[model samples]
Target chain A: MAQEHTVKSYDEELNQLRSMISRMGGLAEAQLTGAIEALTERNAEKAQRIIAADRSLDILEQEIESQAIQMIALRSPMADDLREIVAAIKISSTLERIADYAKNVAKRSIVLNQSEHVKPAVLIPQMVELTKVMLKDALDAYIDRDAQKTIMVWESDKGVDELYNSLFRELLTYMMENPRLITPCTHILFIAKNIERIGDHVTNLAEIVYYQVKGETLDMNRPKSDDTSFAVVPPPANT
Target chain B: MAQEHTVKSYDEELNQLRSMISRMGGLAEAQLTGAIEALTERNAEKAQRIIAADRSLDILEQEIESQAIQMIALRSPMADDLREIVAAIKISSTLERIADYAKNVAKRSIVLNQSEHVKPAVLIPQMVELTKVMLKDALDAYIDRDAQKTIMVWESDKGVDELYNSLFRELLTYMMENPRLITPCTHILFIAKNIERIGDHVTNLAEIVYYQVKGETLDMNRPKSDDTSFAVVPPPANT
Candidate 1:
């Protein structure tokens, strides 16, 4: 899939950049999964691992930025090549945020894990899994230059939001029913929100990919169904 | 302050891009201010106006992207010129996100306005104003090539986080004390969160400006003090 570049080193430099993005994407996925598993299993040690690992993402982000800037400076790439470098930088930033969200989720595990070992929030695992898939697909599409795959990844964010809303209501119900539950449930609420934001960052990747490959913006608005518009009131007592 | 460019049109193009950024900044400021007003005053119409005005920010974002791409394509800009274009793209994107956060805050106005009136969440206006200043200073720093100004903006995000945490605890205390306050307070909580996110985006602007002006990354981690890291157990009832 190598294009006939007059200078082959240009292609090699871009490949190196892509590999960095790929590494960063993989680390974000691992951090997310580790955080979710820690939550579900009440494994504080695992959560700590996720937190400890976030530093690598930070390093990778810095590397990506340097590589991208160097590429632009050395090659003076135009059009699609310029867009690709820009997309790499944007993707790394989003991945760094995703890793931060993972770290947030992991930090909550120490508290939620110590508390009466209740089950993890039901929908969070599902939400995290969806984001993992979306993140993977978004990165894959970028590497393959596949616009259709990127859009599919983009469309999945709505599902994550719907799942998040359900989790929000369910957590609120728990908090209201048992005042003691408030502490743990609030942590779960934020962990879920952090995962939801990761989905958003993943969708951002999709947008960057689509633009990088197709040289056109995604004309459709992002699908968002956050339950914020719904009243946060618990159901009436009789119900 | 025009540098001697071999091509006069390059400076003109950069200036035009700067003007678009300035206009976009103005619109974002208006949206943030209008959203804050609607939340504080319970004016659904004003909230709706802010929501409607978000389209202009979106339009400006698209325009910036197109112009940046076109400039890069036609000029094959190198070194600092390339970085400036990339930075502009990044800043516009962050501005778009800030506007979306404003829209989210405005969206909450309907419910908060409809519910029985309550005093403003004590720190939200303060947070919004701080973000507005950070955002304004960040952009001004970019225009003036003022690394010092951008760093100042970067440092201010910690204060915004402190304000957000305070608003969070106050809202939660009110909701727990009176279930009737849960509904509006929940909306206020989100509005506060939205404003907090606007602050983060403003910090993003600061990062881009610092990089663009100094040709170096800000050598510090983002300041963060989110309460989620703290134990969720309500503070011992006796202060």
Candidate 2:
């Protein structure tokens, strides 16, 4: 009866950790969306909100890390239990980084707001929307422990990279045409880079989820891994 | 006698892990240096060498990861020992990413070699050297378990960022003045960004070393954590 009670307590703690991470992930996804909205819409107030809310994510990350440590100390968890706790810790860190990148994007929006507009870039918003979707899907995958959804998030990152590269070229052309625009365009460049980085972080979380579900490493950069059986057809090559 | 044997075996395993990581770090540092040299000197063969050698770093990373897992399974280490093994795994991943950035730099170097010279940029080479030194010092700090060296490496990262930002502005001017130079200049921009990323990774490794030694999180992005005693002096404001 005592052992059963201990197992029950462990499950409760694990569930609490998962819920906390899920809440944190939700907030991070919202932050990413708000950041993109702030930039694309030039809403300084929304950007400020995104930046201000970063403190909460930091606190949650630290709290979850401490809780994981305490649970490990108390339970000496093994196998799947141990993997889940470690995954929670890693996923929390990755989510916090995504929030940080979102905050960076918001900060850049503040800088870009000071200048007259460059031609509104279509790809930036598209990239932001895709990344936000990936962040949301990755969190959902985590909450449901669905490896397939996680894999979908991983596959979507290539699209983000293509968008970033195209944006880079577009910005390069703008800077070449008008040197005076460099300051504001540079800020915009960083905004795009931060969004791209958030996509990478979401991909990192997906890889962690893959590990939690499969007890194996998934190299998102490489095509061939143990999970190759689930590989989706490559998206039409981006030029 | 059994206790003594166990202690010796534990020490041996820890030392081997340390040795493997140090060698991996050394190889990664070399790869970064070679990649930068290839770009600045326009040596395609050197770039090819860096690209070819990256596979070894990937293999080393996997070996270290598996060894760490085996250690955890066989010994069930606790406290600092457990943290050290976990740190090794995380650091190996960071190092591998740094190697990937180096490969990217090398690939860009090959592309840049095909184009006409964009006025020879000197700052990027200096930035790469600083980052390489930081990686070496950070790894030394890890192996020696020296918090002081880790702190130094962390502080040095601010200088690298300053250099990177300055180079970004300068390159922007070059591309603007000579619009025809955009292709090669963009390649150089990526090279600079990759080196800067390598610096960031080294700083991350330093922070991990600080955590392993101090058992506390140090905010790398922020100048100070809640505790002011360890607050790093902010880099002089970039103009």
Candidate 3:
């Protein structure tokens, strides 16, 4: 009976860890949406709120880490339970990073508000919308232990990268055409880049979810199409 | 006697994990240095070599992760041993990211060689040198399990960010002066950003080391001086 009680309590601990991860994911998703909204609406107040809220994710990550470590040492969970614990730890950290990207976007949005809006700023919202879908799906996969969803999220990140490339060219062109646009366009570029990176992190979350469920690494070479690094836009003919 | 044998094997396993981390850290340091050399020398072949070498770090990270998980499950390590194992996993992943940044620098170096060197490019080596010292000390702290060294490394990252801020402003000024320099200067900007990010990750390593040694999180607020996000360099008066 004592052994059975101990097993039951260990199961409860595992459940609690899952819930903590779930809560953290929810917070991160909210933060991402809030940041993008703040950027598009030029709502510095909202951005500041999102920035302040980021501390919660960090605190949650620490809690998850300490809890996971204690569970590992005390319960000696094996196989599936161990996999779930490890995944929770990694996913929590990933969520923290995603929230950090959101915070960065918020910070940049505050700076962006100081200048005239660049034309390419419109593209960021579109890119962020797609990223949000992937993040939501990745989190769902985690909660449901659905490996198939992870595979789908993994395949979809290419879309985000492709959008980023086009935005990259457009921003560069604008900066080239009007040198005055350089400062604002640069901030937009980084904000878009942050969104793109968030998509990549969501893909990582998908892989972790797949590993937790399947006990195997997601071995597929993720299609990467972010070519902005090689991009060189020539100055306008007048220049 | 049997229990003693088990303890001895566990000790060996922990030592192996530590050595694996040390080896990975060494590789990361070498890759950072090589990437910078490739940038300064404009050596496409060396850049390609550095990019190719990044795969090894990824492989090492996976190996360290699997070994750490196995030890945790099988050895049931407690307290300090457990903290070290967890730190190894986290540190190994951070090292992998540092190597990824180096690979990105190498990739950009190849593109940078295609264009005439921008004047701001000269500042990159200085930023990287500071980052390299921090990386070295952070790794040394990890291997030595010296919490004091972690504190020092944490405090020193401010210098790297200050350098990066200057480099950031200089690049923008160059890009504004010559439209043609925009392409190359953008790459330099990103390369410098990569080095600055590497410095941040090294600071993370220091925190991880401190935690691993002291069994407590480093709570001191790190000094951050990177202000590039808010900078605005106007175009030349003639423009």
TM-score of each: 0.87, 0.82, 0.95
In model 2, the clashing pairs are none
Error of 1 at A128 (Å): 1.5
Query: For model 1, which pairs clash?
Result: none
Candidate 3 lDDT tens digits, A1-239: 43555345776888899899999999999999999999989999999999999999999999998898778777778889888898988999999999999999998898888888787787898899899999999999998899999999999999999999999888878877877777788788888888999999999999999999999989988878888877777778877
Order by lDDT, highest first:
3, 1, 2
Candidate 3: residue B93 lDDT (0-100): 95
Can you write out model 1's per-residue Cα lDDT over A128-198, one digit (the tens) per residue? 88989998898889779999999899899999998988877776666555555556766777788888889
DockQ of predictions, in order shown:
0.31, 0.21, 0.58
Backbone clash tally (model 1): 0
Give the C-alpha miss distance for residue B114 in model 3, angstroms.
1.0
Candidate 2 lDDT tens digits, A39-140: 889899998999899999999998897687667655767788878887887899899889998887887777677775887356789988898889888888
Model 3 CAPRI quality: medium
Error of 2 at A142 (Å): 1.6
lDDT of 1 at A169: 73
Write the residue-wise lDDT of candidate 2 on B1-239 in tens digits: 43555444778998999999999999888888888888889999998999899999989998997677667656767889888887888799899989999988888787777777776468888988898889989988898889989989988888888787777767766655655665576667667777877888888899989889887777556422111111112212331
Cα lDDT over the full model 1 = 0.81
Each candidate structure's count of clashing pairs:
0, 0, 0
Poorest stretch of ten by lDDT in candidate 3 chain B: B1-10
